[model samples]
Structures are given as C-alpha cells and as structure tokens.
Target: MVGIVVVSHSRKAAEGIRDVATEMGGDARVEAVGGTGDGRIGTSPEPISRAIADAADGNGVVVLVDLGSAVMNAEIAIEEAELEEEVVLADAPVMEGALNAAVAAGAPDATVDSVRMAAEDAQRVKKFG
Candidate 1:
C-alpha cells in the first residue's frame, strides 16, 4: 500500500489534514508531520521524514508540505534518512494535493507515482495566474 506524509507548521493543521485523509483513505496508511521549529508555523524535516519512513514500509512515500520551511525540512529529512523507498514531494496546493493523495492511496493500484500524478493535477487546479 502507498503511504502519505502531510507536513504543516501547526500540529493542528497537519492533524486536521491527516484526519480528512484518513477518513477518505479508510484502511490506507496516512501520517502527519507537524510541530517543528518554533511551533508558530513550519515543520521540521526530521520528524516528517521519520513519519514518511514509517508509513512507507516497503512501498514508496509521498510527502505534502504546507509551506516553505516545511518543504525544506522535509527535503533535508529525506536526504538524512537515506530511505530506500522513493519519496515524492508534492508541489501542489496543500489541501487539494492532500485530498488527491488520499484518494490515490485508497485506489487499488495506488503507488507513489500515481499519488504524485494526482498531486500534480491538483496543483494545476490550484495554480493561479
């Protein structure tokens, strides 16, 4: 099964997103990464990466970040972990990307590539001129 890691500055945001994804995903694996740095806003990469690793198991991991630091941190964590599983970072808008990822995860043929595709599509939908 595919694994999802949602990263946000506030624990609440991450948790909330995770809750929505969990509801949509059913038994699929979905994890949250939050409360990093000052806790005001911005997640640390280490914990986020760890969460991804745990959720990934053998399958690859898909990471979705809320903003700047969260993205940087997640990237750093992924590098530090040296995880064997493929880790795809979603450049899509947080909410749409996360929802798409959740749906992809629940799909029978869900994979990191599929999730990434869904996230990219969501991002396109969210993009503004």
Candidate 2:
C-alpha cells in the first residue's frame, strides 16, 4: 500500500488531519510533518523528509500541504530525501485529499500514481449542494 504525508503550518492542523485520515485509512501508512519544528507557525523541510522516510512503504508516498511555504518546503524535502521510493506532492485540499489518498493507499494493491490520483480526484468531489 502507498503511504501518505501531511504538511501544514500548524502542527495541530497536521495532526488533526492525520487523526481523521487515520480513522478513514484503515492500515495505511500516514505521517505528519508540520510547524517550524519548534511549536511555531511555519513549515520546514527537515522534518518533512523524515516524515516521508517514515511514512514511505514500497508503494511510495503522497504529500498534502496546507499552503505557502509548506508546499515549497515539501518539494525541497522530496528533492533532498533522494528516496528510492517516489514522493508526490498533491495540489488538493489538505484534509480531504489526505483522507482520500490514505483510504486509497490502504489497499495492498494501491500504487503511488493511483494514490495520487485519488487525492487529485478528491478535489473534484462535491460534498453537497
């Protein structure tokens, strides 16, 4: 199954999204890397790489970010990690995308691309009118 990483300026936000994803993901590999690594409001590449490494399975990892530097930092983290497994940055709603990706990724047969597609597809979903 693919893995998932959540990135946000707020550690609480990241952890909250991870908690919800956890409830929906079943056995998926999900991890969160957020804040300035000092309980501040910001994003950094350092812990992001660690989270990617920790979350990554043989199926790779999909990263979801809140905004601004979180996306930029996540990109840098992926580049710096130089991981053998692929890391994809998702341009979708952080909470919803992570939940969708996590659920899709929990399947043993799920691939990195498929999990990413799930996150992307999540953006198109309409909750209600």
Top lDDT model: 2
Q: What's model 2's TM-score?
A: 0.95
Clashes found in each candidate (C-alpha, N, C closer than 3 A): 2, 0
Regions of model 1 farther than 4 Å from truth: 37-40, 126-129
**Model 2 Cα lDDT, one tens digit per residue, 1-129:** 688999999999999999999898878888987999778999989999999999876678899999999989999999998988889898889989999998998776788888898988878878897
State how far residue 74 of model 2 sits from its true place (Å).
0.3
Deviation in Å, model 2, residue 80 alpha carbon: 0.4
User: After superposing candidate 2, which stretches have Cα over 4 Å from the reference?
Assistant: none
Best by TM-score: 2
The TM-score, computed over Cα atoms with residue i paired to residue i, of candidate 1 is 0.88
